[model samples]
Target: MSDHTIRAEAPGDEAAIYNLIAQAFAPMPFADGDEQELVNRLRADGDLALSLVAVDAGGVIVGHVGFSPATIDHAACGWFQMAPVSVCPPRQLQGIGSALIEAGLRHLREQGASGVAVVGNPAYYERFGFTVIDGLAPASEHDQPYFRAQAFDRSAPAGTLRYAPAFG
Candidate 1:
């Protein structure tokens, strides 16, 4: 059945959140296996702008996503970065990740964020309005167009992007 619910992560879902992230990234050969720990660091450092989860009809957390503050040319107030989005391996391809992203973006818009950036599969993120613009790229190794942004307002800043220190 296709009836999972997308909701903000609660204070007590730490273990489940970590497991979901671990499970989702296990198949990626390039994964360094530190994504969940990064989430913890983000939470500990107060950089997590938002954290959301997709709970199946059976009340199991099957997907998750996080947004954190990022900067462009030293400006830190308006832009955010979406990262470490994950869904349980069994839950992939069921729209759970998409729902998490859509809900997170809606929440960010409601919070008045000016933009969101992500480094991900180009074909997948393009559906969410993320596009490569000049002068914006992640500090990570990947330099492809998958480093993209979706501007909430009409203007998108042009400069190097620095994700939160927690990403280190």
Candidate 2:
């Protein structure tokens, strides 16, 4: 049986979430080592539209995924950015990260978000229906190649996609 359950972040989950994120990204070559801080910034700036955590049977947070509002063409298009998906090293590769992401996306959809964007491996995000739209792009040229998006009930717009300020 699975040892963890996915759910919304609670008031005291910040410290656990931060530690887990730092541990999860520490070994990744692409990680900038500020992902944990980014999450804190998002929460402080009130840009974290949604945050979910995976809790083990013992009540420890083992995974986390954050969703923040984003803009397309510099307009409020109900788009969000999914980022820093993390699973503790000891608990990695057990689908914990994927489950957190799916739960986050599902919540966003129910909340009427028009779409979600992510900058990551195509092979991974593609499974969640994220794809590169011909005319849709990220504001940062460095992110252009890795950026992908998935539209929900509404059609995605073409133009620069800006992530929340905490992403800077």
Candidate 3:
């Protein structure tokens, strides 16, 4: 396995990040043909809590992950929603995605975030301590079992998870 470093994203990394996301989710059924738009919207809104990228020794981007503000409609609560986690198709299963996620989550926790949510593969995300949250809804009404969450602090709030307007 080649060594890859995961770090906070830089300004010039947008195009590479977009391309990685586009390639990773290209065949998914739920995209509705606007993956690039979603990426752009997230970037433009400045709602991202943490945007991370995995790079090779030479600094070539191989994966990307983003977390933005999420709410649970409860008190003393501020959570992050993980979205658009993408690993270059050729780099899948090489721990790049894991690095991005772990690094991003650590950053969020350091920033005092209470929790984090994710709409992704159940089996895969569960490895990162995420679990299905009943009665919690993604910003949309989409019925997906992969819509899950995890609290960094055990005392984090609980309720229906709400994402930003970009998800609508």
What TM-score against the true fold does each predicted structure earn? Answer: 0.94, 0.97, 0.88
Question: Is candidate 1 or 3 superior in lDDT?
Answer: 1
Root-mean-square deviation of every model: 1.4, 1.0, 2.1
Worst lDDT run of 10 residues, candidate 3, spans 135-144
- What is the lDDT, from 0 to 100, of the residue 103 in candidate 1? 92
Please name the candidate that would achieve the greatest lDDT relative to the true structure.
Answer: 2
- Model 1 TM-score, 2 decimals: 0.94
Which is the better candidate, 1 or 3, if ranked by TM-score?
A: 1
* TM-score order of candidates, top first: 2, 1, 3
The lDDT of each candidate is 0.87, 0.91, 0.78
Query: Which digits, one per residue and each the tens of the lDDT, describe model 2 over residues 10-34?
Result: 9999999999999999999999999
TM-score comparison, 2 vs 3, better candidate: 2
Least well predicted 10-residue stretch by lDDT in candidate 1: 137-146
